[model samples]
Structures are given as C-alpha cells and as structure tokens.
Target chain A: MGVLKAAWWIARKDLAVEIRSRELIYTAMFFAVACLLIFAFAFVEGRTTIRNAPAGILWITIVFSGTLALGRTFERERQAETLRALLMTPVERPAIYLGKLLSLLILLGSIQVVVVPLVGLLFGAPILRAPFMLMGLLALGTTGFATVGTLFAAMLTRTSSRDVLLPVVLYPMSLPALVGGMQGTLWIFAAEPNYELVQTWLAMLVFFDAVFLTLALWTFAPVMGE
Target chain B: MKLGDRLIVVLLAVSGLMLTASPYVIDTAPYEATMGLVQRIFYYHFPMAMTMMLSAIVCGAASAWFLFRRSERADHIAVAAAEMAVVFGVLTLITGPLWARKSWGVWWVWDARITSTFIMWLVFGSYLLLRRFGGAGSEVLAAAVGFFGMVLVPFIYYSVNLWKTLHPSNSVVPSLPTSMGIPLYYCWAAFTLLFVALMSVRIRLERSRGWLERAYRAVED
Candidate 1:
C-alpha cells in the first residue's frame, strides 16, 4: 500500500476499534467534564468571573484530559503488542506517526464536542459568538498537542513509568499552544471581543502547529527505533 | 589533584569571593532613580537568568549532538548542563520574585518573562525527572525534551513583546548607567565562569559514575 493509504488504514483501524470499544472517548469526555466542573467550583466567585475566566479553565481542562487520552491510546498499542506488529509492517515511520496523530485529533475533537458546549453552558461564556474562530483555535491547538503527545507517548511506551513521564514531557513542550489557545479564547469571550488580539493569537497557534508537527514527524523515526 | 583541577578550584574560589563582594559593589553604585537599593538584586538576578538560558542552549546543543552521534560524552554534557540549568533556574526563580516583590509590588505575576522562565525551569526539571525515573531510553527522551525546550526559547523571549506584559523589555539593559552597567558586567563574568566551572565538575562526576556502573556490571557478570 501507498504511504497515504497506509496512514489512512491505520487511522481507520484505530477509529474502528474506538467505535467498537468506546472506552477512550467515554473516559476522556467524563474526565474533561469533571475537570470543567471542578474549575467552575473552585474559581466561580460570581457569574462575572465564570463568564470572563473560562478561557484558562477551558484550556487547562483540555490539557489535563488530553494527557489521559494520549496515554491510554498508546497503552492500548503497548498492551496488545500491536505497536510492534504495526512496526513490523512495511509502513513508513512518518505514515505511522501521521496515522496516530489523526486518531488522537479525532479523539480530542470528540471530547471538545461535549466539553466546549458544556463550558459555555456552565460558565455562561459567549463562546458561540465566534464559533468559527473558536473551532479554528481548537483545531490548531489540539493538532500541536496530539502531534507532540503521540511521539512522546510512543517513545515512553517501553518505560515502566510512562504515565508520569508523558505529561512531564508533553506539558512543557505544549506551552505555546496552551498560551495561544487560552489567550485567543479569552479575547473571543470578552465583552467586546478583540478581533485583532484573537487573530494574532490564532496566527501564533498556526505557527506552533506547523513547526511542532514537522519536528515531530522528523524525530518520530529515531525516537521509535529500537 | 591535577594542575587543571587545582586551577578550576582557584577560579571557583575567586568567583565566589567576587560574587560575595558584589552586594557591596552594587551598593557603591549610584542608586537608581526608580528602583533604589532593592535593585541590587539585579546584579545576581540578571546573571542567573543569563546563566540559566546559556545552560539551556548548551544542554540543547549537547542533546542534539547525542541524538545525531549517539556519543556517551554528549549525553554526559547534556545531563550536566541540564543539572546546572536547574540549579541556576531555581536561583533565578527565587531572585526574580524577590526583585518583583520590590519593583512590581507583587511577589509573583504571570507576565511574559516570568511565566516563560518558570516554564523553562519546569521543562529542564522534567528533563532531570525523566532521567531519574524513566526506565530505559530515558537519555534519548530527555534529549528530545531538551531540543524542544531550546526551540521554545525564542518564543518565550518574544512572548513579552507579543503580549502586553508588565515585565520590563530589553530597553532596560542599554539604558543602564555606567556605574550600574560596570557592576552588572562584572557579575555576569563571575557567574559565567562559575557556571563553566560547576558544569565541568558535574560532567566529571557523571563520567566517574558511568565508569563505576560499568565496572560494577562487569564484576557482577
């Protein structure tokens, strides 16, 4: 099979398994929701604070729960010995990385589907005001997250303490995405949203996603090699 | 000890004495129009920040070399540099806030420079953590983290300009009067030498540890 075809097949396999098992998505959604509620409880001094400060809270929730999802996804491959099997195939390393990234993006997107709207409902955030912008930010930020997260997860899979190591490795690297995402979302939810600021932050997110995705793809082979 | 090691010891002692005398030297410098005596912390704080950043670059470069060449020497340097980064990073973290408390009227603020520095510190801290706890292939993983962290520095440096942060910009450096500037440069020199001395010592320690480990393994086998 061609590289693109191989990547598509791998993504399809992961998504199909997720559909059958439904474990990752359900747990991720629940974890994200729980995080959102906890943030609301801790920070909601009044309605105004909740409405105004949901940006940071929202991004934090995504990061914390996204770490869990990435860990679990890789854990499946490790536990089933499927990662080794996949490697034994003729697929290019970058193709495998691309495929894994696609699955993670889908999983995170699904979690955001529930989490974003629930954040709006709970925090009274006017997130829907610029729904397209919010979606753009989410896509860009989550792409960076998954790109780096998948590479690190695969690198750490053989280690015994991967669960702890994944976040330690991923969080610091994901700062630009987190900062851009939070800042853009903050501007979007402002009383009079600053289109200029939102645009600038979105541009940053785009840059971060491009750079990190390329770097991850370049390094994936070396990192995944035995 | 060898002559080279003795020279390093002498260099370290002089640097330590110079660092100790820096407070008095800073006090002798004319008080700033704005910040006053509390600004003395600048002598140490700025140098620590510079050293931290320098160590990060060293670590990142060493890590990249390790990745490319798979040299155990490169790995040792990377690990040593990372350890120095953490030490200086912690000093920077503490000294920065102390200065901020006096200058900005708050102990901590999530402004751009401070935020980025904190994140950089955590990144290296995590580098050390992974090396300690990650079972195998941890060096490679840590190298990856080091490379990524280095790549993130420009972004962090420019974050202040990108956002409306209260942290002073690069403008503060050029505007320094001669009295203050001289002392600052002296501190910078002292700290840079100190950093190199410490790093060399750490690298030697790592080499010794690696040799010991191999020796033990051979004996056991």
Candidate 2:
C-alpha cells in the first residue's frame, strides 16, 4: 500500500476499535474534566478566576490527559503483541508513526472539543475571541506534542517501566510546544488580545511542529529496529 | 599503561594544575565597578556553562552516530557525555543562583538562557533515567531521546528568548577587558580539559562493563 493510504488505514483501524469500545475516549475526557475541576478550585477565588490561569490550565490539562492516552494506546499494542507484527509488515515505518500520530491528534482533539468550552464557561475565558487563531494554535500545538509523544511512547513500549518513563521523557522534549501554546492562549484570553504576538507564537508553533515531526519520522525507523 | 589511561592521566594532571592556579589568576583580574568581587564567580560560572553546553552537543552528536551507524563506541561516548552534562549542569544551576543572588538580587529568573538550560538539563537527566530503568535495548531508545533533545536546543532557545530576557546578554565575553578575558579563557581551558579527562574515564569504564558482560555470557555457554 502507498504510505498515505497505509497511514489512513492504520488510523482508521485505531478509530474503529476506539469507536466500538469508547473506553479511552470516555476515560481520558473524564480525567481532563477532573483536572479542570481541580484547577478551578485552586485558581477560582470567590467570584473571579485567577488572571491567566485558564491558559495554563487548558494546556496542562491537555498534557496530563495526553500522556495518559499515549501510554494506554501503546500499552494496548504491546499487550496483544500486535506492534511486532505491525513492524513486520512491508509498509514503511514512518507510515506507522504517522498513523499513530494522527490517531493521537484526533483523540486529543475530541477531548479538547469539550474541555475548551468548559474552561470558557467555568472560568469566563474568552474562548470565542479569534476563533481561527485559537484553532490554529490548538491544532499545531497538539501536533507538536503528539509528534514527540508518539515517538517516545512507542519506543518506551518494550520498557519495563513505561508508565513513568513516558511523561518523564515526553514533558521536557515537548516543553517548547507547551510554552508556545500557553503563551498564545494567554494572549487570546487577555482583556485586549494581542493578535500580533499571537501571530508570532503561532509561527513558532508551526516551526516546532515541523522540526519535531521531521525528526520523529526520520528516527522512527532506526529506533524501532528495522 | 594503555594509551587511553596515559591520556587520561596527562589530561587530569594538566587540568588539575590549571584549576589549582585559577584562583590566583582570577584574583589578579580587575574587579567590576558595580558588582565588585561577586563578578569573580563569572570566571567559574561561565566556563561551567560552556562545558555543559559542549557536553550536551557531544552527547547529541554521539547519540546520532549510535542511532544511525550503531557504533558501540558512540554509545559509550554518548553515555559519558550525558553524565558530564548532568554533573556540569548541576554546577551551572547552583552557581547561577549564587551569582544571580548577588547580581540580580533574585535566585532564579525565567531568562531565556537560564530556562532553556534548565530544560536541557532535565532532558539529559531524563536520558540517564531512561537508560537506567528502560531495561534491555534501551541504548537505542536513549540515543533517540538524545537526538531529539539536541534538535530541540535551538527551538527552545529561540522561543524562550522571544518570551523573556532578564539575564545579561551573550556579548559579555567579546566585550571583556583583556585582564578579565585572560583569566576567563584560562578557566575555560581548565574546565574543558577536565571534562575530556572525565569522559575518557567514563567511556573506558562503560567499555569494560560491556566486555565483562560478554565474558559472562561466554562462560554460561
């Protein structure tokens, strides 16, 4: 199969499984809600929410639940010994990596669909301000995060202590993306939104996603042991 | 003695001599008008920072070599360089706060260089942790980690720099007076020599451990 076609099929396979079970989607969304509630308690004072808290809370909730999802997604592959078989296929390894990244982006995207509005509703963040810019930041930021996360989580699949190692490895490597996301969202949530600064941050996010995705693709083959 | 051992011995001796005389050398340099004696720590602090940066580069390059070429020697070098990064990173982190305490009246600042350096330190430290607990076939995994960390260096630097900058800029060395510059260069050489010597020892130790493991397997057969 062609690389893009194979990637689509792999992504479809994962989505089909997820659609049938709804386990990861349900759990990860609940975990994100729990994180939002916990942070609301800490940041919401009397009637007013802490200034700039929503930006940090939104990005952090994504990161935490994203890590959980990355771990379980790979854990499932490892459990059935399907990853080895997947690797044995004649399809290119980059295709496998792309497929995994796509699925993760979708999974995280769905969770955000709910979490973003909740943040705006509960904390009065101006989520509707510059909707396109917000979506661009979210999409690119999630891509950057999931690109690195997928590579590391896939590599960590065979390790004995994966659950702990995934976050330890993923967080530092993906911090630039997280910072860009938070800062962009912060600008959006500001009383007077700075579109110029938001543009700058969005540009940085694009750079990060491009560089990280390229590296992840280039290294996936060797790291997975061809 | 083996060539590696002799090299290590010579490097250690020379660097030791340089380090021993560094205090006097730094003392001879003129003090600053604003910061006075606290600026002296810059000699050590700056060199440690350079050495740590060098170590990170070396680790990343070595990791790339190991991942693509599967060179065992490269793997050994990567491990040694990572350890050096962590050791020197800790030194830089500690001395930074001390200097900042005197210079900026604060322990830590989210300055571009400081934040990126801290993140790099965490990544390298994570590299070590992954190797320790990752079990079998972790060398390749750690190599991937190192390579990714290396590529992220410039991105992180640029992003953080654009965000905030409270620390002194990077042009201090070029603008330094000759008297101060001489001592600063001297300390840099000493720290670099020491870094090379320590890396040699660590690489040798790692190779020996590999040999011992292979020999044990031979006996089992």
Candidate 3:
C-alpha cells in the first residue's frame, strides 16, 4: 500500500473508533476545561486577572490535557494488544507514525476549540484581537508539541512506567514550543501588540516544527522497529 | 595493560596535573575591573559550561549512531557522555548561582543563557532517568531522547535570543585579555581531558557488564 494511503486509513480507523466510543474527546475536553477553571481560580483575584497570565495558562492547559490524551490513546492500544497487531501490518513504519500523529493533531485541535475561548471568557485574554494569527500560532505550536510528543509516547507504549516517564521526558524537550506559544499569545494579548515580533515568533515556531517533524519521522522507524 | 587502558591512564594523569595547576594559573590573572574577586569563579564556571555542552553534543551524536547502526559501543559511549553532561551540568548550575549572587546581585534570573543551560541539564538528567528506569529494550528509547535533547540546544539558543537577557554575551570570551583568556582556556582543556578520562572508564565498565551478562546467559544455557 502507498504510504499516504495507509497513513490516512490508520488515521481514519482511529477517528472512526473515537467517533463510536467518544472516549478520548469527551474526557480530554472536560479535563482541559477543568484545568482552566483551576488556573482561573488561582490567577484571577476577585475582579482582576494577572497580566499575561492567560497566555501561559492557556498553553499549560493544552499541554496538560494533551499529555493525558496522548497517554490514554496509546494506553487503549496497549491494553487491547492492538498496537502489536498494527505493527504487524504490511505498510511502512512511517505510515503508522504519521497516522498516529494525524489522529493526535485532530484530538488536540478539538480540545483547543473548547479551551481557547474559555481562556478568553475566564481570563479576558484578547483572543479576538488577531483571530487568524492566534489560530496559526496555536496550530504551529501544537504541531511542534505533538510531533515530539507522539514519537516519544508511541515508543514508550511498551514501557512499564510510561505515565510518569512521559512528562519527565516530554516537558524538558518541548520547552521551546511552550515558551514560543506562551510568548506569542502574550504579545497578542499585550495592550499594544507588536505584530512584527509576533511574526518572528511564528517563524521560529515554523522552524521548530520542521526540525522536529523531520527528526520524529526519521527516528520513528528505528525506535519502533525494535 | 591494553592500549585503551594505557590511554585512559595517561589521560587521567595529564588531566589531574592540569587541574591541580589551574588554581595557580587563575590566581595570576588580573581581577576584572567591575566584578573583582567574584569574577575568578568564571575560570571554573565557564569551563564547566563548555564541558557540559560538549558532552551533550557527544551524547546526542553517539545516540544517533547507536539508534541507526545498533552499535552497543556507541550506546556505552553515549551513556558515559550523558553522565558527564549531568556531572558538569550540576557544577555549572551551582557555580553559576554563586557567581550570579555576587556579580548580578541576585541568586537567579531568567537570563537566556542560564535558562537554556538549565533546560539542557534537565534534558540530560531525564536521559539518565529514562535509562535507569526504562527497563529492557530502553536503550533505543533513551537514544531517541538523547538525540532530541541535543537537537534542542540550537533551537533554545535561537529562541532565547529573541527574549531580553541579563546574562553576559558570548563576546566576553573572545575579547578577554591574554592573561585571563589563557587561564580560561587552560581550565577548559583540563575539564575536557577529565571528561574523556571519566568516559573511558565508564565505557569500559559498561563493556564488562555486557560481557558478564552474556556470560551469565551462556552458563544458564
């Protein structure tokens, strides 16, 4: 089978299963909302919210819920012993990786659909300031996070202590993405937004996505082949 | 002794002698006009940072080799380099704060260079943890982590430059007077040799452990 075709089918399979069960989306979306409420309580004093706190809070919620969702997605595969069978398929290994990444992007994208606006409502972030720009940054930033996150989480599926190990390993490596996302959003939320500076950050995010996606694709085969 | 053993001995002796003489060399360098005596910590601190960065690169390259080529020797070398990165990273982190407290008048700041170095240390520390706890077949996983950690160095570097920074710029080294620059380079060379010596010993230990494991399997069979 062609690589892209196989990848699409694998992604479709995951989405189809998700559509039937509604397991990951429902839980992850609730988890993301709960995460924001907690942050809202902590950062929002009776009437006023901390300056620039919403940007950090928004990214943190996405990452935290994303981590939970990433773990459970693979945990389901592991529990059913389906991942091994998936590996046994005739398609190339990168197909499996791309498929997994595609599904994760959709899952995290859905969570962001809910979480982004909630941050606006709760923290008064200027989400409407540059709507397209905000979405672009989130898309690039989420891609950066998920590229590395998917590679590591998938490789970690066979391990015993994945839940603990995932964050320990994932957070440090993805620091740049987190910093970029938060900073870009902060600039957008600023009283006087620096569109030029935000564009530079967006460019950097693009660079990050390119480098890590190439790396994740290159290493996925070897890491998972074993 | 085998040539590898002899080389390790020689490296250890030379590195030991250089490190012992480093204090006197640093003492002779003139004090900075601004920071005074606190600046001398730069002799060790700069070298520790250099060693840690080099060790991280080595670990990453070795990890890539291990992952692609499936070479056990590369894995051992990568593991040893990771340990060195951690050791020197701790030294860098500690001495940095001490220097910062006196020089910057604060214990820590979110300076670009300092934050990037801290993140690097965390990455290597996580590398060690993954290896220790990742169980069988973890070498491949840890190798992937090491490669990613190394790849992050430049990205963090570039992104940090976009932010405001309090850390002294990299130009501080190239523009230094010969007296201070000499001592600084001397310490760097000494620290590097020490890294090599320690890595050799650690790699040897891993090699023997592998042999012992294979022997145990053979005997059981």
Candidate 4:
C-alpha cells in the first residue's frame, strides 16, 4: 500500500476507535478546561497581565491536554493485540508515524479550538483582528507538538509508567514549538506584530519540524518494534 | 604509551596550561574582576558546555544508528556518548551555578539558559535511566531514547523565552572580542580534543565490559 493510504488507514482506525468510545477526548477536554480555570485564578492577574498573556495560556493548555490524550494513544493498542497486527502489514513506517500524529492533531486541535476561545472569553482577552494568523500559529504550534508527541507516544507505549513519563519527557522537549507558537500567538493579539520575534520564532518552529521529523523517521522503527 | 595516547596526554596538558594562563593576561588588571579571576572559569566552562552539547547530539545520532543498524557497537557508542555527556553535563550544572552566583547574585534562576540546561540534565539522566527499565528489549529502549533525546534542546532553549525567566541568552557561542575570544576558542579546541580522548578510553572500557558480559552469558548457557 502507498504511504498515504497506510497513513489514512491508521488515522481512520484511531478515529473509529475513539468515536466508538469518546473516552480519550472527553478526559482531555475536561483536563484542559479545568487547568485553564486553575491558571486563571491561581496566578496573579491584572488586565495588563492578561493582555500579553493569552498566547502562553493557549499553548500551555494545549500541551497539557494534548499530552493527556497522547499518553493514552498507544497504551490501549499495547494492551490489546491490535498494534502487532498493524505492524505485520507491509506499509512503510513513516506512514505509520504520520497516521499516529494525525490522530493526535485531531484530538489536540479540537481541544485547542475549545480552550483558546474559552481563555479569551473568561479572561476577557478576546482575540481581535488577525484570526487567520492566530489559526495559522495554532496549526504550526500543534503540528510541532504532534510531531514530537507522536514519537514520545510510541516510546511510552511499552513502558510500565507511560502516563507521567510522557509529560516529563515531552514538556521539556517541545519548548521550541511552544515558544514559537506562543510568540506568533502573542503577535496575533497585539496591535502591531513584532516582526522580528515572529519571524525568528516561525523559522525555529519550521527548523524543529524538519530536524525532529527526520530524526523520528530514522529512529521510530526500532523504538516501536522493540 | 602509544603515539595516539601520548598526543592526547600532551594536548590535555597544553589545554590545562592555557586555561591557567588566561586569567593573568585578561583579568590581570585590578579593575577587570567581574568574571575576573572567577571569569577565568570561562575557559573551562565554555568547553564543558561545548562537550555537553556535542555529547547530547552524538547521543541522538548514536541512538538512531543503534536502532537502525541493531549493532552492539552502536549501542556501546551511544552509552559512551551518554557517559561523556553526563560528565560535561555535570560540569555545565556546577560551573553555571558558580558563574551565576558570581554574576547574577542568585546562584540559580528559572532563567532560559539555566532551566533549559537543567532539563537537559534530566533528559540525559533519564536516557541512562532507560537502561535500567527491563520492561522490553534493549533495542526498543535505545530507539526510544534516541528518538526523544534531542527534542529537549529547543524546549530548554525557548522555555525561558516562552515564559519570562531570568536566564540571559548569552547563547554559549556568539562572537567575542579577540583578546578574550581567542583564548576562549583555544580552551574550546582543547576541551574538544580532551573529550575525544576521554571518549576513546571509555569506548575501550565499554567494549571490554560487553565482551565480559557475553562471555559470562555464554558459560552459563
């Protein structure tokens, strides 16, 4: 089968399983919203503080919630005999990767859509103007997160302690995407875009995607097989 | 000693001498004392940072090689690279704190550079931690660690930038004034050689250990 077809199969398989049991996304959404509420009250906040703050809030929420979903993504596969069957197929490995990452993209992207606006609404920091830029930043940021997250999700699949291990390993690693997205998101909110910071962050985000994607491709077969 | 061994020894000795000499020339004047006598530590600190960074990269590379090739040599090289990384990583942790105490008043700040390096220590340490977790095959663990290893660099880097942190981004390797920059570069060169010397020795020791383990297993079987 073609790589795209394989990816589509994996993606569809994951989606079908999730739709049958809305267990994963529900938990992720609950955790994300709850965490945002906590961050709102738990931290010091002035109107001015909230003004430059929505970017961080969104990325932080997405990461935490995305990880919650990602940690569970492959665990169930291991628990059952499903993954071994998938591996027995003749499809290339990167297709398998793209498939797994695509699943995370859907879950996290959905949660992000919900949480970002909620952050704006409750915090009274509405996203004005630049909706396109904001959405693009989210796409870039989420892609970087999923790219790294998919790799870690595979790693955590076999380990006894995948839940906490996922965040511990993933959070510190995906800082660039978070930073890049945060900055781009930050610019989206401002009256004037900080052109230099925006460009630098965008470049870093893209560079991160290229390098880690290659590294992941090179490393995934063994990590997952073993 | 063999020629290769002697050259390494001589190079290490020369580097040490240069590290010692830097303070006298640059920080000699009574006024130039911020990173002064203590700043002389820059000579070693930069090299240690370079080695740590290099070690992390090599760990990632070796992780990939070991996974794809499934060779014992790749695994050993990776473990060796990680051991070397830990040594330099420790130096980074220690010297940065010392420099911070002297430079920033507070020894540790949740700054960009500081926090990122700390996270790297955790990540690298956890790489070693993987060897202990006997859940599955060695190949899997190596692949997992390799896959995730280098991902830490960006997060550690941009963490501070994302949230406001106290660590300044001296970026470990921006251009420097010739007076101080040139000596620092020598120190870097020296440390690079020193690290390779250490890696060679460690790789040899590791190979011996691997042979011994196999021999023991063979006899038992």
Local accuracy by lDDT, each model: 0.84, 0.91, 0.89, 0.72
Question: Across residues B119-200, which tens digit of lDDT does each residue of candidate 4 receive?
Answer: 7777777676655553556445745665466655764576455545321245343222245566567767767877777776
Q: Give stretches of model 1 more than 4 Å off.
A: A45-49, B159-161, B165-180
Candidate 2 fraction of reference contacts recovered = 0.79
lDDT of 2 at A224: 98
Off by over 4 Å in 2: B165-180
DockQ order of candidates, best first?
2, 3, 1, 4
Worst 10 residues of 4 chain A by lDDT: A42-51
lDDT of 4 by residue, A1-226 (tens): 8888889899999988998999888999999989887778754365444456666777788888888788788887887877787777788878898898888788788787788789778765546556766777788788888887888778667677667566766766676677778877776666566655655566767776777677677666767763
What shift in Å separates residue A32 of candidate 1 from its native position after superposition?
A: 1.4
Give the best candidate by DockQ. Answer: 2
Model 1 clash pairs are none
- TM-score for candidate 3, residues paired by index: 0.95
Residue range B114-197, candidate 3, lDDT tens digits: 888998999999899889988888889999999989988888776776754321344332222345478898999999999999
Q: Give the candidate number with the greatest TM-score.
A: 2
Candidate 3 vs candidate 4: which has greater lDDT? 3
TM-score of chain B of 4: 0.78
RMSD of each: 3.0, 2.7, 2.8, 4.7
What DockQ values do the models have?
0.55, 0.67, 0.61, 0.34
Residue A48, model 1: lDDT of 49
Models sorted by lDDT, best on top: 2, 3, 1, 4
Per-residue alpha-carbon lDDT of model 3 for A1-226, expressed as tens digits? 8999999999999999899999999999999888888897899888878977888899999999999989988999999999999999999998999999999999899989999999999889989999988998999999989999999999888888889999999988887777778788888998878777788788888988988889999999999974
